[model samples]
Target chain A: MENIDFSLVDWSRAQFALTAMYHWLFVPLTLGLSFIIAFMETLYVKTGNSEWKRITKFWMTLFGINFAIGVATGIILEFEFGTNWSNYSWFVGDIFGAPLAIEGIMAFFLESTFIAVMFFGWNKVSKKFHLVSTWLVAIGSNLSALWILVANGWMQNPTGMRFNPDTARNEMVNFWQVLFNPVSINKFLHTISSGYVLASIFVIGVSAWYLLKNREHQLAKKSMIVASVFGLLTTAFVVLTGDGSARNMAKYQPMKFAAMENLYVGQQNAPLVAIGILKEDSKETLHKKQDFRFQIEIPNMLSYMAFLDPNAYVPGIKDIVHGNPEHNILSFQQRSEKGKIAIRALSDYRNAKKAGNDSLAKVSQATFEANYANFGYGYYAGRDVHELIPNIPMTFYSFRIMVGMGVHFGALFLVILLLTLKNKIDKKRFILYTALWTIPLAYIAAELGWIVAEMGRQPWVIQDILPTIAAVSQLKSTSVQITFWMFFILFTGLLIAEIRIMTTSIKIGPTEDLKDSVKN
Target chain B: MKEILFNIFQFYYQGFKSMTLGKKLWTIFIIKLVFIFLVLRIFFFPNVLKSNFKTDDQRSNHVIEQLTK
Candidate 1:
């Protein structure tokens, strides 16, 4: 721990966060719009409507521009896994690299190939073939999302694998368990559906702006109608899967859920904080007398969300950090103690094996097996694991913002959905304005969701299995700092270019006809 | 469904076959992508963990020493 340079870790984190946040800005739109464009292309093929073709091509043009820049930044992550977190690469690369490699071979290749065809196949190929290409591109993009998230989920709950001390890494034993991990599946659904919601909002918001401008009424209205209906369905799925995600969190990482709610003491039928602000650090509050300065909580909602039972006992940060006898929750100190023994036993076992002392090796193996579950905490030998608690204030607020934004998006889409049903969307000026304004809200919520997911799980690179400190590469902090700023500045310029290109394309609306522009 | 996919694949195969200029351009694209993603990766990013410890016993020993240190 002392050998790990703090600055190096911080700089590497900053670089990864910068690239990930930037990568996300483009990805949700790509994931969501790919499906929307496919639907539009299907409409064109089915009804033989050139207008739908125009609409699809128009969105496709924006997608292409975004896709190019997204690829340019996306490559940075794969490189960083080795360069920035070299230890992490070696430690878990056995399991983690599988999904990434599969993503490249299966999803990335499929996506890049069909995307070329989807973009350039217009005039060259038959309309049917072109339509197929569009759908394949959508599937390819979302499939790419699935594998990456599966990897992330494995980190959150390291199931389907076993630690091999000899190899000094986690190795996968059951690919199916890794693939079908409850957390991974739920996260995939929730994340991809959120993307759909974001795309819906983007499309509807842009269309509303056009409606506000009194231009492209047909395209705007049609897009708004399609996006709103689709947005509503996806939003519903997002909520369902979000519940599954929270429950998974409560089971595997209760500390995160406790932080999200700012609950200091364990309680039966724990209330969910709809919105709350943390109080100034007072001895009483920190020690579990009272936690929040102000809060609006719904009775039993947190318990319900976590366990599907209103009366289920939910552990809080205090209960979790300290041993809770009644709930049988081991304190961080206890786990830390056990983890130390496990780590030491592994060392002893290695030594005994080298010396050909079978009896000593067997005893060491037994000790290692007994305490292996707490092995990660062994690294923080002299301190309580409670000290490793994530930033409560940041995690708490980010969780609320994500949930609050989700509710707002869900409601906004439903209103638009209802209005579309009534065929009165064009007349609703207030709704149109709200839709236009809420576009940024969607982006904010999307970013906040990631903040909550990543930030809330902090101090651990892999939840309960590996702390971030142990995962970073031993490298000069200054080099990482230099690259962080380099990427930051470069991505900032790309963002400005992306915005300019997208806005201009949207303003131009669908090309008059796909005839001349469809040149191969 | 398999037959439909096969037909689609055939269409693409023949489409690439007939286009002399497009085929040449695509070949370059494939080569560049493979070089950038695969070839460069080996030199720039070697797995230090795997290379440093030659065996399970050695790797385990290193972890133990580091943790205790």
Candidate 2:
């Protein structure tokens, strides 16, 4: 703790967060829009309608711009794992790198190889072949997402890995367990579904813009029909998987769950806060309980949500920090002590091995294994209990915003779909305007989902295994700071370029002649 | 088999030759990728574990020292 550079840790985290958030802006759009474009292309092939072809090409153009930029930022994020978090890489690279390598070798190449035919093979390839290529592009993008999310989910709930004492690294024990981990499944489904919802909003919003301007009415209306239906279907999955994610969080990461609900005290039949405004409480008071300026809650809902039983006891931040004997929850202090013991035993084992005392080494190894579950807590042995708690307000508000916006987008999708079906959507100016404005809100909700996830899991890079402080590379804070600003500028420039290209393409409208289309 | 391979190669060759905006976009993509993988990676980012240690034993030893100390 004394040797640890807090500044380096903070800067490294900031850089990663910056890169991840920026990369996400382009990725979700690529994930969902590719599917939407494929569906449109499928419609064209089935019906032999040129209008559908134009519409497919229109959305495909936007997808291409987004996919290109997304790959740029994504490459940086992968490299950062090695450059910024080398220790974490060394510790879990065996398990972590497998999924990532599979993604690069299989999913990425699948996407890249097919994407050319999907884009440039418009007139060159057979219609069926082109359509299949389009579908492959969509599936490849999502498969890429699946592998990445599996790696991320493993970090949240580190299963299927065993720490080797001699190697000082976690090695993969069961690949299937890591892939099918409950946390990974829910996270993958929820994240991709959210992307589907966002892409739907993007299409509807862009189409609504055309409607507002009274241009490309047929194209706009047809796109709205497809996007709204797709959005509505995926939004349902988002909500379903979101509930699964919440349940998993409560089970696996109770502290994060508690912070999300702003719960400071343990209780049975706990209520779920629907909306709340928190007050900045003094340190002493905060340790006891967090003050809420105003809140609306549903009785027994939190208990039911967490454990599927309204009467089940849910421990809060206080209950976790200070042991809850009634519910059999160990306090942070107890865990920290166990963690310290594990650390000491590991060191002793290493020393004994060096001295050729095999008997002593074996005894130390047994001790280390017993307390290894709480090994990450060893870093916080002498720290305040407050250090164990994640930021309450950030997690709580991010959860509410993400959820509230999701509901809003779901309703918007349903309304837009129904109206489009009735042939009354274009006439409804307010609804059209709302659909148009909802694009940014959709992005905000998506970003907030990641914020709640990453921020709520504070301190730990790998849950129960590695705290972030120890995971960071031993580097100067200035180096990380310099790269952070460089990435900020580069990503921002790419985003602006993407926006300009997309807007120009949109304004050009869907036309037969590429040259005339740009001129128009 | 030779004709099939030639046809496949021709399919992509003709598609690439016919690209309008696609070529420009591909150029931008290539430039961005080169900047990221070559420039940024070479100058700013390095695989610290690989760079600092010659073997797994040394890397693990260093990490163990960090963990215990």
Candidate 3:
């Protein structure tokens, strides 16, 4: 408690964030693009349309580039668990490693092996076989995502695992419970559906560029239609999934929910902030320091969103940190005290075994079980309980930006679809230009959403059970610093090269591919 | 073998030179990345894992003891 190391923890977190941020840049594109390519290939097989095959090949080339880069950054991310967060790894590995292992053995192989077939089997295999390969690539990639999300979801809200004092680690007791966590399902669907929106926007943007250039007209028109339709469907799912994700956060991580909305007071029928700014001079606000400045709010929306009940009493940041016994919620300090009890009980149980006292051991074990739920609180008990409340302003703004982007994208996709229907896609030059630019905005939104999820869970890496400070590897900060630089250099170089190659390939276009296939 | 290699090099050489301001973009990109990842991290972030516990067992025990307290 007296001599806490801050540098090593900060550097390790920085390195992990760097790798994850880079990995994510490429992943959503791959997740969404794979399905688009598969659908195109399917239509090709169904209608025997050569144009469809060209579209598939054109996008396949880009997907390959994105997937290759994703793998490059993703490998670094997985290794970080062992190399940087060894303590968390050993503590939660029993339950955490299952989904990751399954992802590797089942999902990774399905995507990777068939990906080769999908890319190379165009001339080498039958049409149906190639189509199947394309579909497999899509299925495999999404399944891989599902498992990793399950692993992440478990970290966010640990369940199906029990702490063992003897081994000083948690052990898995229920695989099904871990696999089917509501947070995991919501996270998986919301995340992948966002990927779908991103991919559709990417497709539509590229097609829009082609229409603007007055090149590849027929191919561009059809691709835009498919992309716009795909965007529409996925954006619809994204809204529903986002709602589900917010609900799950309220249930499993009420603190995050409170911070995201910047709610400071416990109340029934809390209004959701439509848009608001945090008071900069909070100390001057005197009584209500963290309250938002002048803003728009929809009354009862937050309560209805968080809990289906319109009058459900929602606890705010203050209520969460202090006590809200009226709602049967213990203050964070009380939880910390309980966590300490759990820990002491476990220690007593261990000592009891040494003393050959069976009844004492049984009693201590029962006590440990009763209080273990607050185990994470014990680590932060001596510190300011207010620190358990994450960065309110950042979480609030990031959630708003992410949600705002999703809404804008949903509307944009509809407009694009309407223009396509009118058959005046090219005539609408201003909208076409807007479509071209929305590509980067979509990526920004996706990243902001992740920032909200991750940064909003600050202080705790394993939510309520383990603080991030207690979960890091016991390695020198210098080593992590060096590796951080190494990855920064490597991933950046790869990203630049990838863009150069991808843009060049895109500019070259699908015409040559069609000709080459026709000749063959 | 040398001729084939030369042809490959020739292809990439032209490709690189064909793009305007390619070198300038690369220079800016590398500079910004170094500043963000290395320079900025030094000023803004500090390593927290190194100061507290010297060994793995010590770290685990510290956490356990704290929880048990």
Candidate 4:
């Protein structure tokens, strides 16, 4: 620890932030756009509508472009995790490697193989076969998301795994336990719904643009109705899933929950702060450092969300780190060793109460808790345990932005549905001006929501277990800078090329321009 | 054993006749590259790095040495 510089930490973080932001620009579209294309194709099959087929083909071209860029950006991430955080991967490879390998061997290969056929075999393949291909692509994209979330869930909940000092790596003790972790289900649902929101908004947006131009009125109307239905379902599900995601965090990652709530002291009842600058306010009458002014608390909301009991106590960050008997137990330097003691104590209590010698079972459970406690201790020792977590204010604001947009879109969808009901969708005002502008905002909200969930767990790459500082590559700062530059250049070039292909495809307008006799 | 040998030869003869000369060379080049990649992975790498690294905390350091090398 002596004479080692912390500046590389800053450099690596900045580089990662940039690369991740750039990469994310393409990924959501790949996740969301494929679903929209599949919906269009399914509609065509259902209604025997030629326009629906055309819409499916048009969006399929855009999806192809986005998919290619997403893959290009993503492949580098797999290598960078190793190249950048050489030590971290070696340390957690036993657990980390499993999800990643599954993602590659199972999901990536399935998606890529079918994608080529879907993109190029439109005329060559039967209609039913093509539709199946579209569905496969959607399944493949989501399956990839599922595996990545499993890896992340292990970090958040630290389940089904333990670090062996002899091996110097955390190994998976139970495969099923790792897959069906308490946090994974909620996080997976939340992430996938956000992807749906992104896809629906994009479909609605481009269709509205055509409506505004009065270019493809009939096609645009169909696209809007289908997109609106998807949008409504996804938006509602995102909100419900967000609540579940928060509750999961509260149970397993109390520090993250407390940080997100910005609750520093233990309290019987807590209020949710809406928005404001967080500052230390010293008052003449009171000695307490008031964290915020003009803050509003919704009574018992957090308790209801976290525990399903309105009066249940939610531990604050201060309580978790510095207060009371359990807090002190966690704060000790030899905390993992202390964990062994607690496990033994619990075992004795259970044995005495049950009147049986289940010593073997007790020993295993003790070992599990002891190893987990050690990992937690490792995280705290590396980072500023208090400030180094889910950036509370950012998460709080992003969560609201995402929720606000969801509500706003729900209202917008209702208004559109009303206009459609009145047989006024063909009317100029409803079709041209109102719906067109609101389309872009949906994707924005989706992006912000994801930023909140992922960025919220900062400082630690793996929640409660590994600090990002410990999880990243230990290469010289200059090496990271060079690779970062190389990636940025390559990614930007691919992004531009993808945009050009999409633009040309849309401009050329669905291969009909090459028709008449060029038809197969 | 004789039948297996005969079948292997037949497979190689069919493959040779099916492809152009340039394609065959490219395929051979890729195969050789893969062979080198596997060799570097197995005996040459982790073993060579393990030899170079000597310290109390040798395990993690050994991984880095192998990966970087």
lDDT per residue as tens, model 1, B16-44: 67553344345544553564466545654
Supply the TM-score for candidate 4. Answer: 0.78
Q: Estimate, for each residue in A1-520, the C-alpha lDDT of model 4 and write its tens digit.
A: 2223466766666666666766677777788778878999998778866777777777776786666545645554555565565556666766888988898887758886677557655665688888898899998988888888888777777778866543446789999999999788777778887778777777666666675565666666777777778778887898888888888877777766776676777565565565545564435212111366556667887777777777777777666655446433244235434533443443343434356556644664455455555443443343344544456667666776777777877776666656655656666566446566665676577667667766777656666555565565555777666656755675576667656765565555555332421343
- For model 2, state the Cα shift of residue A444 in Å: 0.8
DockQ of each: 0.23, 0.73, 0.09, 0.08
Error of 3 at B59 (Å): 11
Tens-place lDDT digits, model 3, residues B1-69: 999899656645654465343354445455645554465445433332234557756655654554444
Q: Write the per-residue lDDT of candidate 2 for residues A159-234, one digit (tens) a residue.
A: 9988898999999999999999999989999999999999999999999999999998888999999999999999
Which pairs clash in the backbone of model 2? none
A481 Cα displacement, candidate 1 (Å): 1.4
TM-score, chain B, predicted structure 2 = 0.89
Instruction: Give per-residue lDDT, candidate 1, residue A483.
Output: 69
Question: To one decimal place, how large is model 3's interface RMSD in Å?
Answer: 7.7
Write model 3 residue lDDT over A246-327, tens digit each, in one string: 8989998998998888888878998889999888878743223386677899999999999988898888887888788899
Q: What level of docking quality does candidate 3 show?
A: incorrect
* Candidate 1, residue A164: how far the Cα is off, in Å: 1.5
DockQ of 1: 0.23
| Candidate whose DockQ is highest | 2
lDDT (0 to 1) per candidate: 0.80, 0.90, 0.80, 0.64
User: Of models 3 and 4, which has the larger DockQ?
Assistant: 3
- How does residue B35 of candidate 3 score in lDDT? 51
| Candidates ranked, most accurate by TM-score first | 2, 1, 3, 4
Please provide, for model 1 over A403-440, each residue's C-alpha lDDT reduced to its tens digit, 9 standing for 90 to 100. 88888888888898788777788889999999999988
The 10-residue segment of model 3 chain A with minimum total lDDT is A284-293
TM-score, candidate 3, chain B alone: 0.43
